[model samples]
Target: MKLKKLMTILLTTVITTAVLTGCGQQENAKDAQKKPLKVATNATFVPFEFKGDGDSDYKGYEVDMIRAVGRVMGRDIEFNNIPFSGIIPIIQSGDMDVAASGMTITKERAGKVLFAAPFYESKLVILTNKNSGIKSVEDLKNHSVAVQMGTTAADYAQNLGLKTKQFDHNAEALMELKIGGSDAVIADKPVADYYVATEGKGEDVVIPIPDSKKEYLAFAMNAKNKDLQKEINAAIAKLKETGEFQQIYKKWFNVDPGDLPKTAEETLQ
Candidate 1:
């Protein structure tokens, strides 16, 4: 009888262990699926995503917007500061899940990654010293222009047959313009305007690029992240509906939020 009772107890203990092990495995799977998203940004673009003063985290339009999206999705955002050039490649490799680098949506980039809703309206412009006399895109023909590598501005300059100097960051490219290493700096309209309004005041001038088409900027992710793209787009739409999107826009830009493009395609009806 003693032997039989001992055998029964051992069998019960084995069964209980197996059941608990299965439950633990299932819980681990759930936890893995809920892992925080890794967001990559080059914290060099002011009013977009730049490091704040005194041990503060990144503060800018993109940073705020990403945080808002994470809140609406009930997901946590894990920020990784990286160079703007590597933003896309890392997304493709699954090293990062989102790009918050204030990236302009281009047809070529659209082919490589999925874009969320367009957030900011932008265009290219020329930034130069007031004494440089570069008032138009045509004026850049014979001048050495500085541009941030991996940006549409660089491609635009190259395509326009201008002598171009590429820098890893737009700030450096702008500095090159200030130091006379380049005759002019070509950058996104908003960034140039920000510099002109703040640090570049009195000494710098922004020339509207003639025939420059309107550009849209947005968040991008791996092409395979369609579900996440939908969630983000939905979150942005909600933010717009709640008027939070415009609030954020006004906070950084001090301007009314205009209607955002529904898609990146320039010809959208």
Candidate 2:
């Protein structure tokens, strides 16, 4: 009777161990499947996803690129539109998976987040009123230049020895410029061009900066997310090769896409 009882207890212990191990494995699998990536961005910037012309839907360049990336990766990209300054902090705190707000892959930003290769390039332009007589950066030396806060354009404007009036968004700064509250505005070329072409107030603006101040934009992910960055790089390579990237560029900028390096193209190879 003692031997039989001992045997039954041993058998039960073995079964319990196996059951616990199996449950752990199943739970791990489920966790892996549920890890959908969240991409953070500042959607207020136009031609790169913003609240549409009074509509609720998002529109513009980054919107199309994010959706294309989702399709290529077989995953959904959830865009969290936060303040520009909040993007890096949120990513650092593990609140977001990636950021793609036409972000310039600068050395400072690169140190904070893993940046993918350059996917888009935009010129840095200065905008001044038609009657301001500010035709160049030099013209704004002592004048107050309005720029979007916490942006590279703002940094550049400061570096040029201009007095800066920083606003949270480019639209606000541009508005100030139009109302004669600022001497000039510094921003990306596409945005300046868009405003000049569409907004009545922007009609008086002139692009004072040349093409040499162009900036390259890339996607950013947490430093720990090497795998996600690799996947994104692969997707960029695929899009570049299949000509889809060029099409999107044309759609947004009305220009053919620039050339990518052989290494960037061969990343997935």
Clashes of each: 0, 0
- Local accuracy of candidate 2 as per-residue lDDT tens digits, 35-107: 6668888777776767766786667887788777767877777778787878888888878887877777666
Model 2 worst lDDT window (10 residues): 260-269
After superposition, candidate 2 runs with Cα above 4 Å error: 1-35, 200-202, 208-212, 261-269
- Candidate 1: clashing residue pairs, number: 0
**N/CA/C clash count, model 2:** 0
Error of 2 at 247 (Å): 1.9
lDDT of 1 at 117: 90
Residue 239 C-alpha lDDT in model 1:
90
Against the true structure, what is each candidate's TM-score? 0.87, 0.84
lDDT for position 31 in model 1 = 85
Which regions in candidate 1 have their CA more than 4 angstroms from the true location? 1-34, 53-56, 264-269
TM-score of candidate 2 on Cα atoms, chains taken together: 0.84
TM-score of 1: 0.87
Choose the strongest candidate by TM-score: 1
